[model samples]
Target: MLYIGVDLGTSSVKLLLMDESGDIKSIVTREYPLYFPQPGWSEQNPEDWFSALTDGIKELTKDCDKTTVDGISFSGQMHGMVILDEEDKVIRPAILWNDGRTQAECDYLNNEIGRDKISAYTGNMALTGFTAPKLLWVKKHEPENFAKIKKVMLPKDYAAYCLSGVHCTDVSDASGMLLLDVKNKCWSKEMLDIIGLKEEQLAKVYESYEVVGTLKKDIAKELGLPESVKVIAGGGDQAVAAVGTGTVGEGMCNVSLGTSGVVFIASKEYAEVDQNALHVFAHADGKYHFMGVMLSAAASNKWWQDEIIGTKEYKKEEAAITKLGDNNVYFLPYLMGERTPHNNPNARGTFIGMTMDTTRADMTQAMLEGVAFALRDSFEITKKLGVNIDRIRINGGGAKSPLWCKIIADVLNVKVDKINSAEGPAFGAAILAAVGCGKYASVEEAAGKLIKVIETTEQDPVIVAKYNKKYDIFKDLYPTLKTMFDRIAE
Candidate 1:
């Protein structure tokens, strides 16, 4: 049997085809434009995503026997607000998870609404990236558009709706919306009331690996597949990626350094993890997970390499860096503001301690280390929750960099394992599809059979000690510049 995994990403929709045994058959990607209507505001037309998803599916399954495709599922960018009218027409461009234009609404939720009360209701602090704040922003600033919201879904759920004709979302993705009462696995009525939204506007929730609906006849015929093809409820990218990496059981961990970075620790219960709370999200495995997110990870390097350096020779540029944990320069990877520890939307990317003697390699190394240190900030929080993590399964675009992987190993003082496939989210989506199709007994079994660690980057004791001190300085920089970041935004 074959399954399809559609990863609806920020810049592209990546589709993967795999067998029941987890062998990848084919892969295809379709790119789409991202819009920045204003600085710090990010948006994408849901129509563009739907087009990419459908077109990519056709290309992805062209060589295979379409009848054998048992299921299709998704792993998508979470927390994006995709609102639709009564007729299901998109009301506006989706407010992407990386967008920082909802600071005012986040402030209102965290302060006027009271953090303690909001946390009690949703198990998360209101962050600018969350869907609720984006909704509040729209309601306050664009009331006309807000009034048209008849159903709301995350990025992937939109594609699910297009395929299966079901207005539905999975627990993992909805947890990021700041509207789900995560512990209870339901929408928080308090949050709905706060946003002045009715329950009918939201999608029906499901577990990530559950079968939500079958393919619509029209969509199935268009994609050269059967209407009997099951539409599985795949998950938010991070949770599903954890499944792909075998991070399903309690205390198992996966760190993703994709467009965004996440330090994800899978848990079985919904209890509070720490004083920081550390982003308590519903896991794709029908449980819970604690996550710490950075808005920019490989994206920061992509900007430096593509937009600024004018080259895609990332490895060639990385080859220039001979120093590890020894750079004088420091970069704050806040190109899209921050989320994890310092929920600061006003934060801007900064390069400090640069001198005339600073080489491109030094600055490059700083960018890499800066992201590692930021992830380490989350690792610290997980440790505070008494979660013992000695090794982590690492996957993402940044995981392809040997230097960056080694830096992550030393910075976190743990073994970083690289799996066979770098397509974490897409692969995980396939696993969810497999589980939904009864190809595997459970997600854990599917992951265990499929994911193989190809290599491990062992931590260097000397570099680890060096980074321990460097991280101390790195953590302080954000706090020191908080007031300045706020002032500059004004």
Candidate 2:
């Protein structure tokens, strides 16, 4: 049987067709517009996503026997607010995960309500990107729209609901909403009440690999597939991406360097870190995991190359950076504020310790090293929680660079393994579909059989020592500039 994985991303919807043996048959991507109504606010039309996926699926399965398709699942951008009216129409453009318009709501949750109380309720402190804060913002500012809300769904769940006619979400995606009692795997009544939301407003939560419903008759017929095709409740992009890279089971780690960077560690049991710096969330494999997210990773490099340096030749520019740890210049990768340990929206990108002799190559190398050092800040928190991560699986655009991977391995002092396939969240979603169809016993079993490691980057002791010293200084820059960032923002 065949399975379909729909990765509903911020910019596009990617559809993947895979057979039961894990061979990818076809892949199709369709891009949609991302709207910026204000300087820091991000939004997208839910209809655009569904339209893209529907058309992409038709293109993806054109040459194949559509009747053979057994199931479909999703992996999507998390924490976007998608609300529907009583008639099931989108109430407004979705507030994206990258949107930073909830600062006031976040401050209210963290300061007025108290971070300790919020953390005790949801196992996380309020952040500008969280769904609960966004909902609060809507209630305060767009009260008319809030009064019409009948359903609340995440980005991917909106697509799932459109296809299967079932309102559903999985544990991994719900964990990011700040509405889930993450440690208990249920909706937090206190959080819902605080936000003036009821439990029924949310989708029914399921494990990532569990079946949500079958395809709607019209949707299945429209896509030239069987009506019996099951729809699996998938996971958040990062959690499902972990499944794709075999980052399941205890102590397994995966470092992603896409637009945003994440250091994900799978755990056998729920564990909370100090100050709630690292997110404690449910894993796709039915266990628990911790994740530390940095808002800008490859994005910083893109900004430098495209906007600043005016070049698309990333490889050519990186090829000039030979002296890795020897550069005197240092960069702080806070292009879009920051998350993880700092959680400061006022932070700005900075290039410190530059001199008259500083070359473009020196700055380039510093930018790469800066991202690695910031990831280490998150790793340090995990270490404090007593989670021993000796190695990590690396994916994303930056992972394609050997120099960047080497820098990360040495800085973190952990083995970095490069996988053969970089399909990421889409591939992981297909694995969930397979498991839901009984092709595999569980998500872990499916991942173990599908994911293959191709190369391993080992840490050099000499390089590690140099980066350790550099990281010590890099960690101090954020604190030193915190007040300045706030003042400038004001």
Candidate 3:
């Protein structure tokens, strides 16, 4: 049997085909244009995502027998607000998760509504990216559009609805919306009233591996597949990636250094919100997980290489850097503000302690180490919650760098394990589809059979001690510059 995984990303739609044995048979991607009407706002057309998926799937399955495809699932960008009218037409281009225009709405929730109440109710505080804030933004600014909202959905759930004729979302994805009472695994009535939305506007929530519905007859015919092809309710990108990396059960960890960075840790029991820093959400593995996000991870390095250094050869630039923890330069990796510990949109990137004697390699190493230290900030928070994680599975573009991997290992003082497949969320969604199709009994069983740790990077005690000192300095820079960042953004 074959399964299809759709990674609905910010810049493109990536489609992957995986067989029952976890081999990637074929993969294809299609890019779509993103619109920025203002400096801080981000928007995209839902039609573009649909078009990309249909075309990419056609190309991906051209050589294979499409009738053999057993299931389809998705791993998508979370917290984006997608609304449909009474006629099921898109009310407007989706307000993307990364959009920062909901500051006023966020203030209303965090201050007036109060963070303590929100945390107690939704297991998270109001952030500018969350769906609850976006809804409030529309109600205040675009009241006309607010009244026209007959149904509300996330980016991937919209695609699932189009394919299966079902309005549904998995628990993991719904947790990010601030509408679900995460601990009890149901919608929070208080949040619904606060957002001025009814329970009917929400989609039916299911476990990540549960089958929502089968493919619609017309969609199956168009793709030359059987209508019996089940559509599984997959999960948010980070949650699915954890399952793919076998970061299931208690104390298991997965660190993703993708376009955005995340530290995902699974726990056997429900953990409450702490300082509104780490996200408390439902895991795709039928458990609970805590996540900390940094808006810029690999994108920081990409910016330094392409926009600053004018080079596409990242390996070549990093190859010259041999120094690990002795660099004099320090980089604050806040190119896109920050998320985890400090939810400051006004924060800016800075290179501190740079001198004339600083070499190119020193600056490069600082950039890598700066990201590692920032990740450690979140790791510190997870420790405060009494969740002790000693090892983590690593994925994403930055995970390919040996030096960066070593930096992360020493800085966070945790074992870093590299898995065979680096497909992240898309591959994870495919595995969930396999589980839903009965190819595997549970998510943990599927991962145990499929995920292989090819290598492990252990922390060096001496270097870890050096980084421990460096991290204290790294942590202090953000608060010290908070006033300056706020003034400059004005």
What order do candidates take by TM-score, descending? Answer: 2, 3, 1
Model 2 local distance difference test score: 0.93
Model 2 residue 121 CA deviation (Å) reads 1.0
The 0-to-1 C-alpha lDDT of every candidate, in the order given, reads 0.91, 0.93, 0.91
Residue-level lDDT of model 3, residues 93-176, one tens digit each, is: 999988989988888888999999999999999888889999999998999999999899999999998889899999999999
Report clashes for each candidate as comma-separated counts: 0, 0, 0
- Candidate 1 — which pairs collide? none
Show model 3 residue runs off by greater than 4 Å: 305-323, 354-357
Clashing pairs in 2: none
TM for every model, in the order presented, reads 0.89, 0.94, 0.94
- lDDT of candidate 1 over 328-418, digit per residue (tens): 7999999988878876667999999999999988888999999999899999988877788889988878988889999999999999998
TM-score of 2: 0.94
Output the TM-score of candidate 3: 0.94
Candidate with better lDDT, 2 vs 3: 2
